[model samples]
Target: MKLPKALAFDVFGTVVDWRTGIAEQAAAFLARYMPGTDPGAFADDWRNLYQPAMEECRSGRRPFRLLDALHLETLVQLLERRGIGTAAIGEGELLDLAYAWRRLRPWPDVPPGLAQLRKLFPVVTLSNANIALMIAMNRFNGLEWDAILGAEVSRSYKPTPQAYLASAAALCLDPQDLCLVACHHSDLAAARACGLQTAYVDRPMEYGGARAPDGSYEQAWEWRAGDLLELVRVFTSH
Candidate 1:
């Protein structure tokens, strides 16, 4: 396979371990705000609302909202469902908790893999995370990027062609000259449909120890590997 000039990554589960970060933070928050509840379950609950909230904007059911806003909305609903008073949680801490997505830790393999890939090709993030949130993650985790381009830049979400095209355009590259590397098959499929190349990196722990990812190298994709380090082996050899 010919190498592309640039690579765009899916940030959340693909680049960082959101489940662990969210669960730990949620546990700390719950210890103070609500006692004896399971933080890991709460993390899953918050994430479960992620796609549906974005779909509201993607389908035009609501005006475009940043991913931060969607995370807040879902957090509020979870609070209410748990019988915790949203007002009692207070506005400031509530906002901070919602933005916890910005503070996720990278997978153990991310730093070395991204560093190697950056040497091989221009690497930027292509994610549903809003720009501010993505930047915070970059700073928090020290994941250097050549550029950050995603839903905020395009005013669209993943699985939407506009987002992928906008990301490639931001780098002054054609769709085929950019590859979308992600843990989610749906995201890669969308990028493929938009004429961008696709690479699948398995993240079995993305859902924490409770669940496993759905796809394997057995599926048809332009590239498949255990992790980003393995991808480095592929592109660097070419």
Candidate 2:
């Protein structure tokens, strides 16, 4: 495979353990706000709303909103379904809960692996996360990124051609010159369709093992690896 000019990453499940991070933060919030709630289940429930919320914007049913906004909206909905009214929680508290996304813990391989990858090519985020949230995660995780470009810059969500094309454009490279690294095959398929190279990185525990790992693809990709470190090895080997 030809070397890519830049490596665009899908941040959430690919780089960080969002489920664990959200559950950890939710535990404290739930203890005080809604005692006896199962934080892990709560985290899963909140995450289950992710795609449908983005689909609203993706389908043009609503104007594009930041992931932060969508997260807050979903959190409110989740809480309401539990019989907790918005009036029961202060806006400050709600915003703090939403900010949990910004403080996610990186997968064990991510920080060092990304540092190694950056030496070879410009490594930037191609995530649905907004710039501000990405900034916070970068700081929180000590991640080194060449740039942060994705849905916010593209004004569209992943699986949409615009998100992939716009992210490549942000780096002043042809879509084929950027390799999208993601755990989700659907995201990689979308990038491939947009003329970008694709790398499938296995993240078996992304959903905390609730779902089966999707290592299979309809067709071979430019690369595949078990983790970011393995991806670095693949690049160097090529």
Candidate 3:
């Protein structure tokens, strides 16, 4: 089947590897700020803080916080836990490092796959990544988005009706006229429920885990492909 007029992607894991990206950046920052520190190890430790930080809010220990804020909080906590001093870290200076997310190296085939798809559809993003993050990502890394829609615009998180519609509206198309492509099944399910076409691109490393994506993920999506490259073939072939 031909893809819809717009292709909306889930940013974090779908577009870039946040865990790996942040970890690498963490190592570099820690090295600069605290020499003799093993940044790789620090990075790994820092990554471990992401999910729990979000879950605390999701589980009601804290209220909803944007992903950016959560990352900052997690970084700060991890820095303390690591015995690294934070006197050098300035207000929002470290958070600004989130530009790392924007500069993340595109998945092996992402740039090319997007190139192919853009021939047929206007490419865009629908992600939890903040607006400044997305804009800087484009400026630094050549992400050729016609427009970028993030939770910052809708002031709500993904899988919400509003997030999906934010992309649809930004594209100036109806939900069905847009396609939401993500590695996570939940994002696709919510987009589908909102009347958008769905594509699930498998990024098994999204969680930095070895186990296969659960059986439920196999059940939730309309189309599944190994990655964005394969997805291009799958979508355009039919």
Better of 1 and 3 by TM-score: 1
- Per-residue lDDT over 106-207 for candidate 1, one digit per residue giving the tens place of the 0 to 100 score: 999999999999999999989898889988888898899998889999999988999999999989899999999999887887888899988899888888
lDDT of 2 at 235: 91
Counting clashing residue pairs in each candidate, in order, gives 0, 0, 0
Residue 162, candidate 2: alpha-carbon lDDT: 95
**Per-residue lDDT for 1-238 in model 3, tens only?**
4557778888777877666766677666766777787655565566667667756754557767777677677777877776766676776667666445566656677888888878777788888777777777767657687777857767567767887887788777988888888887767777888999998887877556644344364555556788877887887776
Cα lDDT listed for each candidate: 0.88, 0.91, 0.73
Q: Which prediction has the highest lDDT against the true structure?
A: 2
lDDT of 2 by residue, 53-90 (tens): 99999999999999999999999999999888989789
Cα lDDT for residue 234, candidate 2? 93
Least accurate 10 contiguous residues by lDDT in model 3? 210-219
Scored against the true structure, residue 96 in model 2 reaches a CA lDDT of 93
Q: Write down the lDDT that model 2 would get.
A: 0.91
